[model samples]
Target chain A: MHSISPADFAAILLSLKVGVTATILSLPFGFAAAYLLTFKEFRGRVVLDGVVNLPLVLPPVVVGYLLLLLLGQNGWLGALLNAVGVRIVFTWRAAVLASAVVGFPLLVRSIRIGMEGIDDKLIQASRTLGAHWYDTLVTIILPLSFKGIVAGSSLMFARSLGEFGATIIVAGNIPGVTRTIPLAIYDYAGAPGEEAMALFLCLVSVVISLAVLVLHESLAMRLARRREP
Target chain B: MKLAVEVVKSFGVFRLAAAFSSAGDRLGIFGESGSGKSTLVNLLAGTMPPDEGAIFLDDECLFSREKGINVPPEKRRIAIVFQHPHLFPHLSVRGNLLYGYKRCAPENRRIDLESVAGILKLEGLLERGVNNLSGGEKQRVAIGRAILSNPRLLLMDEPLSALDDELKFQIIPYLKGVCEEFGIPFIFISHSMTEMRLMAERVIVFEKGRIVQQATADQLARLRMPTSQVGYINLLKLGPPRQVDGLYAYSWGGGELLLSFPVRRPDSLIELSSKDIILFKRHPEAISSRNLLRCRVVATFEAGNRTGVEMDCGGERLIAEVARQAAVELEICAGGELFAAIKASAFRELG
Candidate 1:
């Protein structure tokens, strides 16, 4: 850590911050979309599912380009935010937004699969026992689906760590603010004979992903054991 | 408590049209699967709504098309115990019990946790995790949890179906305590005739999405609601302890049944399993059946794999389920005279 350059350290810190913030910001929306898709019987349910998952199948560059068109300085939303002196485009917040959009489908998919696996009888039992929907969600749905939710959050954080295509176009490569690990690696790879630095950043990304996955697995194992008779 | 249901619901080719009002506290609905027993219970629980009809409980409309009144389940003060326990996996047994108990309106909280736990014998299980409980233990906790909620009406959808015979009988007394002791009204749904005879104060027979009849067991039998499917339940008439067959005897119909257990209560109802009754052409000489009565076949009906011979002894009506081959060999028919031999152990006393 002492031998690492200041630019490399900034890239690592910024990546962690952006990845964590993006996952936190998207958690509510991800859970809501997944719950709606899994439980509710409504018109256009298929369309809602498809829209939530669009980011996963769409190209990252297209996602970034579309985000740019919608949030650029001259863009309507951009102008609205600009008039309030709040800039979301080409800033650290923009990095978080880009990561959130790109990682949302994975989060929702995992949570939805978990929620779908729960017994419908349990929900009915809760209702018959005088629990409202919100009470059931808090007492039954959320706790039982925690495994999938945590797994999804970890996956989204890892995805955000490696995000480059969308992050570059929208958040830009500002060193301290938005130049995360992937952007830094991209910069190193582009420079003449900076192969060693780029390889080091790639190794760091792999380690971070492994660490997150390990944490999730251990927590899931503990939960499994706790549920055992 | 009173339940008045006049509901019509259709799904695909299946249709359910039932209208009945039972003032009895312990009511049982008996039917085969696909006979809409579960569907009717779901309707009562407020989980499933009727397509077109009205449901009322003590003048308060639970569901009505014209009134535009459909009360949600939680507010209906009705609770259900399913075949499976359906305990919250996230909560401990105590937590699950308290969940409903705490949520009930304070003024209406007649059923408390301690009393329920005591009745259901859920003492040691309070702190255990719900997922870690045995099947029978889970069911006990489930009953306690539902009872603790202080529901005006309880629906049991084969709650003991998942248990073994030993566990099933063991838990039956607790159910009696719920009705007889606590005075809570409940509707139990099952396909088992024995269970109905044991639990039902008023028996409702359902067939193919409709309630065919609703009456006491004796009335139900006399009504001839397919006696083959539902066995005979007789109210036992106790006499002073007599050393008959070296055991205490109780008079049933024209004959006396010697029992290992002493019959003290005159109100005890006993079920005679039709499958256990044996028909003989003659009085039969060296057999240990102990009780035999001269019977004349009142009616006969085909019951799928077997023939049902309804016999009349004095005023008692007993349906003996006989195999088709046996019925043919024995030359059993309406108005035929035969002796019905009941093993001393065949009598199951229910109080």
Candidate 2:
């Protein structure tokens, strides 16, 4: 209650950076996976779907362990990555990677629901009007499913802000670096006589999450108004 | 333009196999619902490839399973007007009209934006959104959009089937506007015989996904094979309508037809049901009926519970359905001249 602590400022800023980076970097894959799941037909589609959703049901620690063996030094992929002089373990890049992995399923599930809700007749109509499949996807499917995209993006952004279990295992709690709000709260809660700092960090998380949701709601409403037919 | 199509496709228990070749622009395909008319339209538009067949349009192979030549809908130089005016809701009328226009190459393009807008009478509604336009107006904009794409041919899948009767007829003339302006061949698929007669120079009748008959208008009328909907139809040219005794008089074929509507269009299509005309062997005088045509019977046959007579009146063939007892009592037979008495009502407008 005395003043703004340097540690709290660093944690908040780091949290925002990781959440935004995770959202922007994972968006393309999320869209591709959701659109593919909604439209395409091939063998093992259900199996591929299950694989994308595994992160949602499986424990976060298990996910972090898999990432560790795959990306850590002396591991198969890690050794290859080290050869390229790119060390991601115990760094901010690893923090973003962990957040993206944890939040991707939510993003894809919401976008897929959006794509499924579109009227299929419109897609067929577009094709008949001299538009290729790719053109139809961009002009008809994406514009109509924009609401779902907004909902998914905001949900993923909020989820990434609160990521903790997997992020701690992979990125570690390096102060002024990979330590985000959740990690900072965990640190304060673990110390003696630091309950105030923990509660302040919790309040900050709630405010940021609420702001994102409110902003998303307003933008979604504007887009929907423009689409009234 | 010439079209040759022989295709076979199956969906679950339903199968569609149609084959026909014609060298006309204003062609009509008529069939009942679920008779694969829509599927045939899709095959023509190149949106759905035929399972096993070939389609040739003016020497250009649109689809060939053997030759591996399947031009997609985008590159086929074809346009479609569906039953519902499936306009893009997010796009304004201008955007909807310009979508294909911008995508088409300049060499393939012939009709410009302003010409189509003027022809379809959509010049004023260019900026309006689809939701703001009426059903008729939306259909007009749809026609404009299809024409502006500079298609070599247009595929109309019951485009006017969604509108009401008066509205449907009102838009029929608009179709003529396009036909006269662009001279682009049209393959119209519809279930209504009235619509087929109005738009088609050559008619192909479909039943259960098979080509039952393909002939001209006169040849089709002669083949009155008693199919429930379009048994025997006589088209009359409507003259200027005048009200008399609270009924409207429309003159055609050296006579007049009385109706209830205040129809004003001259040369409009009026369909008279053959089953409603009463036969008079003695030419009864002072009868309540208005139309009493002296005709020579060309043929007579058993049609259900009645006698079907194909009569010729001044180079025009007419079909009249008379009861079996009346026909036997009047001694109705082939090559016998008789008077056909018809009441003042029983007239329907097709377009």
- DockQ scores for all the models shown? 0.57, 0.56
TM-score (0 to 1) for chain A, all models? Answer: 0.96, 0.96
- Candidate with top DockQ is 1
DockQ category of candidate 2 = medium
Candidate 1: where is the Cα deviation over 4 Å? A1-3, B221-340, B343-351
Pairs with steric clashes in candidate 2: none
Ten contiguous residues with the weakest lDDT in model 2 chain B:
B221-230
- Classify candidate 1 by CAPRI docking class: medium
Chain A vs. native, model 2, TM-score: 0.96
lDDT of 2 by residue, B132-209 (tens): 899899988888788878788888899989999877988888887786688888988888776777788898988888
lDDT string, candidate 2, A200-225, tens digits: 99999999999999999999889877
RMSD score of candidate 1 (Å): 5.3
Candidate 1 per-residue lDDT over residues B193-274, each given as its tens digit: 6677667878888899998877775455544433455444443445555665567786656666677666545545566677
Local error of candidate 1 at A178, Å?
A: 1.0
True contacts kept of 2: 0.54
